[model samples]
Target chain A: MNLRIIKSGVLDTVQDQGRYGWQHIGINASGAMDRFSAELANALVGNDSAQPVLEMHFPAASLFFEQPSLIAICGANFSAVLNGEPVPCYQPILVNKYSILQFERLNQGARAYLAIEGGMNIGKWLNSYSTHLKAGAGGHAGRPLSTDDEIRLNSSVDWQSYLERNEFRVLPWRASDFWEKEPVDEIYILPGREFSGLTELSQLSLTGKTFTLTPQSDRMGYRLLGDPLEMQNREEMISTAVTFGTIQLLPNGQLTILMADHQTTGGYPRIAHVISAHHSRLAQLSPAEKLRFRITDYSMAEVLYRRQQQHLHQIRYACQLKLEWFIHAGH
Target chain B: MSLTIPYHIFPLGDSAMTVDFGSRISPELNSAVMKLYHELQLTPLPGMVEAVPAYSSLSVHYDLLYCSRHRPAEQTVFEWMGELLDKRLRKLDYEEIIPSREVVVPVCYDISLAPDLEMLARERNLSVEEVIHLHQAAPYRVYLLGFLPGFTYLGETDERIAMPRKMQPSPVVAGSVGIAGRQTGIYSLSSPGGWNIIGRTPLKLFDKDREPLTLLKPGDIIKFVSISKDEFEDH
Candidate 1:
C-alpha cells in the first residue's frame, strides 16, 4: 500500500519512539512530540508501539491512498474527511485505492498522528526512523514531507481482516484506553537540578501562578509568558546535558519548557522537570493556552507514572481480548 | 588527602535524573562524571534507560514504571541510586581510560570568512598574525558537545585570543570558527551566534549518513590548522 501527498500541510514528518545510545556523541533523542498519541495510533493498527507514523501539525494534510489499507488517526481532534464525508477519529478504518483524505484545522491541540498498518517505509538512522530536523537525519531524506511526496508501506501486508472488521466507524472502542484521555493541562513537575536556586517566595509562586503558553513554541521548547520568577543565584553555569520537559529558569526570570527536539545540552539553571505523566499535555498545548504547574514529590511522581503504565498494559490486554472475541464471534 | 566530592542527585525533568558531582568546572569533576557514567551503564538499574554524561554531572533517563516495580518500599529510588553511585565511585579504578579519537580541524584564516577578524584582533590588543599564532599554539580538548549538532565546545581557550562574545549576536554561517571565554567552537549549522568570529573551516562537523556521524568526540584533542581560502574550498 502507498500514500501520495496532495497537500503537505503546515508540517508533517515521520517519527518513531526515539534514537538512543548516541547522546555521548551529542545527538539529541529526537522523536514524536506527542509520544503517547503516536504510540496509540501505532497500536490501533496492530503495529508495534515503536513503529514509525506521520506526525501532522495543525491538520491541513491531504493524501491519496494508492491501495486498500487499514489506517488510524489519533491525537488531537482534527477535522478529518474522506471523500467529502466527515470521518471519526481515534479508530482504525480502511480506505480503498484512490481515496482522498483531508485534514482540516483543529479546534484544539497542535499536533496529531496518522498510522498506516505496515508503518511508513523509511530509512532508519541509529535504529530510529524519527527525523531530527536540525541534524537532517532520518525520515524522508531527513526532511518534512513536501507536496507530491509519496510514502509507501514497509511490506505488502494485507488488511482484508482489518478492513472487514472495521468498515463503517471505529469499533465501539476507546482510543484513550491504550493511552490517556484525562484533562492534561494541569502539568505535574518534580524539583530539578536548579530547583534550590529559586527564592522560597518564587518557589511558592511557581505552584501558585498560572502561565499561558506563548506563540514562541515548537519542538525545541515552549516560551511561557507569566510572572517573572525570581532566582537565588546569578552564577553562570558550564554547559550540561538537558532533555525534554526541563524547565529552565532564565536570567530574566522566564520559564522555558524544553520539548522533543530540544538541544542536547544547555547552561541555564533548571528549576523543575515536568513529570513524564504530564508530557502529553505539553505536546498538545496551543498558543495562549493557560497552564499550571503542580509541584509534587518524587515518590508521588513515580506513583503517577506507575499508574499510567498499568493503565496502558490493561488497555493493550483489553484490545487483544476484544480482537480475539471479534475473530470467534460468528462473522 | 583527597577531599570528599560534594554532589547532589536531582531530576532534570520527569524522566531524567541528574547527578551533579560539583557546582564548579574542573578536570577532576569531568573525569569523575565519565567514570560514574561508565560504572552506571555497566550495572544499570531496572528502569535506567540512558545516561547523558556532562562536564560536572551525569543525567540518567529511566522508565518510571520499571523503576517503581523494582523499587523497594524501604528504600527510595533516589537514595538507592545515590548510594549505588557512591559505591561505584569508591570502587572505581582510576587507572582505566576510555578510547578517544584524535581529530585535527583545518581552519582558513581568510578575510572573507573571518568577517570580524580585524575587529576581534583590535579588541584583544593583538595583531592579526599574533591572534592567529596564539589560536594555533595550543591543542584544545572537546569539553562538551551541545547547542547544535556536532558543535564541539572545546576547553581552555588561548588567553591571548580569548575575548568576550560579540555584544550583538551575528548570524553566522555554518563552519564559522569563534571563541568566547576559555572556549572555542565551530558553528556546525547556520545559527544566531554570540561568539567572536575568527575564521571558518570547510569541515563538516556533522554528517548524518556517516557512521559515527559527528566528527569530534568528547575527550578528543582538536588542533586548528591555518589554511588559505583556496585550500579550504579545495577540500
Candidate 2:
C-alpha cells in the first residue's frame, strides 16, 4: 500500500516511540511529540505500539491513498475529512483506493497522528523510524513530508473485499479515554537538583505564575515568555546530560523545557522536570499557550505514570481482541 | 593509581538519573565518569538502556516499565534504580583502560581552512606558526561528544593559546577544528559556532551508515597531525 502526499501540511514527519540507547553519543531521541495520540492511533488500527505514524502539526497533511487501507487518526482534531465527508478522530476507518484524506484546520491541540493498519514501510535508523531533521537521518528521506512524496505501507491481508462493500466504513468502537480532551494548562513538575539554586522569590514565581510559550520554541525546547527567573548565585556549571522535559533556567532568567529533539548535554541550570505522564499533553501545547506549573513529589509522579500505562495496556488489549474478531468474521 | 572522586547521583526525571562527579572539569573526573560508564555498559541493570557520560556526569536512561517489573510492588522505579546504582558505585574498580591504537586525526591548518587562525594568534600575541605548534604539541583526550552527533569535545589545549569563545557565533563549516576556554574540538557538522576555528579536517566525523557512526568515542586519545592542503584533499 502507498499514499501520495497532496499537501505536506506544516511539519509532517514519520515518528515511532523514539531513538534510544544512543544519546550517550550525542544523538537526539527524535520521535513523536505527542506519544499519547500516536499510540492511540496505532491501537485503533491494531498496529504495534511502537509502529511508525505520521505526525502532522496544525494545518495538517492531505493524503491520497493508492490502495484500499484501514487507518486511524488521533490527537488534535484537525477537522479531518475523507472524500469531502467529515471523519471522526480516535477510531479506525476504512478508506477506498483513490480516496482523499484532508485536514482542513485545527480544532484542538498542536499535532495529529495518523496510523495505517500495518505500519509504514520505512527504514529505521538507530532502531527507530523517527526523523532527526538537524542530522538529516532516519524516516522518509530523513526530513518532513513534501508534496508528491510517496510513503510505502506494509502489505497486510487483502482489504479490497472490505472496500468493495463500502466506500468508507467507520469502526463501531473508539479508543478508551486515557488523555484529556480539554487543553491542560496546569503541568506538574519535580524540583531538579539545581532547584535550590534559585531564590525564594524565583521559586515562588515558578509555581505561582503563568508563562506563555514563546515563538522561539521548537523541537529542541520550548522557551517561555514571562518573568525571568533568577538564581541566588551565578555559578558556571559543567555541561551535563539532559533529557526530555528537563527544565533549564537561562542566563537571562528565561525558562526553557527540553523536548524530543533536545541535545544530550546542557550547561544551563536545571530547575525542574515535567512529569513523564504529562509529556504528551505538553507536546500538544502550541506557541502562545499559557501554562502554570505545580510541584509534585517523586512518589506521586510515579503513581500517575503507572496508572496511565495501565490504562494504555487495557486499551491495547481490547483493541487487539476487537481486531481479531473483525478478521475472523471475514469483514 | 586509583582516584577517589566524590560524586552524587540524582534523579533527572522519572526515567533517567544523573551522577555528577564534580563541578570542575578535570582529567581525573572525566576518567571517573568514563570508568563508571564503561562498568555500566558491561553490566547494565535490568532496565537500564543508555548511560551518557559528559565532562563530570553520567546520565542513565532506563525503561520504567521494565524496571517496575523487577522491583518490589511497593518500591518505585526511582528507589529501585537508586539502590542498584548505589550497589554498582560501591564496587567500581576505577581502573583506566588504555587504548591499543592511537587515533590520529589529520588536520589542514592552511590559511584557506583556518579561518580564525590569524585572529586567535593576534589575540594571544603569538605567531600563527606558534599557535599551530602549541595546538598540535600534545595529544588531546575525547572528554565527551555532545551538541551534535559525532562532535568530539577534545580538551586541555596549551594554556598559552587558550581563549574565550566569540561574543557572537559565526557560521562554521563541517570538519572545522575550533578552540574556546581551554578546550579544542572538531565540529562534526556545519553549524553556527562561537569557538574560534584554527583548522579543518577532511575526514567525516559522523556517518549514520557507518558501523560505529562516530570516529571518536569518549576516553579515546586523539593526536592532531597537521597536513598540507593537497595532502588533506588526497586523503
Candidate 3:
C-alpha cells in the first residue's frame, strides 16, 4: 500500500506531536504547527493522535493512491478533490486504488493534514516522525515531497471490498471547526519575563496595534511587522531556553513569535507568548495576515487550554465509535 | 565548601518556569544551575517534560494540563511548582555534588585554520603563538549549550585574549574555535557566527550516531590543546 506524489506542494513534510525531552542537546520538538487539526485528522481515520500525518501547504501535492484505504483531510480547506469529484474536508473517505487526489482551490487556512488509517511509512529520528528540516533527518527521506516520491502506507485496513466500484466514498460524519467562535484577529498572549523591560511605547503598541506576519516567516518563527518595539535599556543578555509561542524582540526592534521548529534556546529578549490554545489558529494564519496581541494571565490561559483539550477528547471518542460502527457494517 | 545559592523563580510562559540566579557568569552561579540540573535529571518535577540549564538559569518545561489535574486543590499549578522548587532548595546547600566530566579537545592553530588569529593578535599587540598560548592556557567552564547543537559557550577566557564579537557574522566551518567577549566556544556545525575564529578542531562535536549526541554538556570542564595541521586531518 502506497501513495505516490504526482506533484509536490509548496512545503510538505511529515510531522506529529513533535520530538520532546531532547532540549538538553539543543534538539527542539519540531512538530505539527496546528496540532489540533493533526490530531483531528488522525481521529477521523481511527488512528491514534500521536501517529504522523502528511502536513501540506497551499499548492498541496497531488497524489495517487496505490491501494484502497481510509483517509481524512483536516485543517485548511484546500477544496480537496478525488478523481475530479469534490470531497468534503474533515470527513473520512474510503479511497480506491489508483485514485488521483488533488486540491483544486485554496479555500482558507495555511496548512492541511492528511491522515491515513495507519500512518506514514517513514523512519523516526530521535523517536519522532517529525521532520527536522535543518538537521535533514526524520520523515520521508528527511525532505519535502517532490514528484515521484512514493510513500508506503502502514495502513492495516482491507478496504478493497469496502470500496467496491466507487473510486471514493466520503463518510457521513464530519467535525466542526473547534475554534469557530474565537475572533481571528486577537491572539491571546501572556507577558514574558522581559515584558516590563520593553519601553512603554513598545509595550502599549503590543496590544494597541495590529501587526502583519511577514514572508520571512517559516517553521522557525513568524516575524511580525508593525511599529518597531524598543527596550528601556540596551543590555547584553545570555542565551536561554525558549519554546513555541515565545515572542522575542530582535535587536532590529522587530518581534518574532517562535513556531514549531524553534531552536531550543535564543538570545533575544522574550516579550510575550501566545497562549497554547491559540497556537492552532495562529499557525493557520498565512503571511500578510494581521493580528493584535491581547495580554492574558496564566489562569485564563489554563482555562482556555483545558477547554480545547476537552473538545478534542470528545472528538476522539465520537470518532472511534463512528469508525467501529462503520467497520462492522459491511459495504 | 558548599555555598547556599539565592535564586528567584519567574514565569517563562504558561507551560514553563525559570529559576534565575542573578546575571554574572561565574562558576559559582553556574554550579547552582548545574546542581539543580543534575538533581532534576535524577528526580524531575512530576509534570516536567524537561529542564534546560543555561549560564545562570534553569528553565523547567512542564505539561501544564498534567500539572493542573495532578496538583492539590488549593494550589494553582504555578504556585505548586514554586513550592516544589522552594522545598528542593531549602533542603540542601551545594555541598552535596555530582561529579562533572573534564574534557580535553585538540585544535590546529595553523594560520590557514585560524582566520582571525593574525588580526586578533595584532589588535592585542601579541604574537600568534602568544594568542594560542593564552586561549589554551586556562581550563574553561562549559556554561551552556545554545545557538546550535553542541555549539558550546565556554567562558572566562584569559583577559588578554578576550575580544568582543565581530560587527557582522562570518561564515564559519564545523569545529571552528571562536571567542566573543569573555567567552570562548567552538562552532559544532557549519554556520555563520560573530565570534573571532582563532582555531579549528577536527573532532565532531555532534554526531547523531554517538550515544551522548553532543561532545560537551553544561557543567563540564574543558581544555583546548594545540595540534599541528597534519594532526588535524589524521583525526
How many steric clashes between backbone atoms does each model show?
1, 0, 0
Which pairs clash inside model 1?
A: B157-B182
TM-score of each: 0.93, 0.96, 0.96
Where does candidate 2 stray beyond 4 Å?
A176-183, B1-3, B96-101
Q: Please say which candidate is ahead in lDDT: 1 or 3.
A: 3
lDDT of each residue in B114-190, candidate 1, tens digit only = 98889888988999999888988888777677787777787777777788777788799889899988778888888
Pairs that clash in candidate 3: none
Clashing residue pairs, backbone N/CA/C < 3 A, model 2: none
DockQ of each candidate, alpha-carbon based: 0.67, 0.77, 0.67
User: DockQ of candidate 2?
Assistant: 0.77
- Highest-scoring model, DockQ: 2
Model 3's CAPRI class? medium
> Order of all candidates by lDDT, from best down to worst?
3, 2, 1
Deviating ranges (above 4 Å) for candidate 3: none
lDDT of 3 at A284: 88
Task: Please give the lDDT score for candidate 1.
Answer: 0.78
Q: Candidate 3's residue-wise lDDT over B149-181, tens digit each?
A: 678889989899989889999899989999998
Interface RMSD of 1: 1.8
Better of 1 and 2 by DockQ: 2
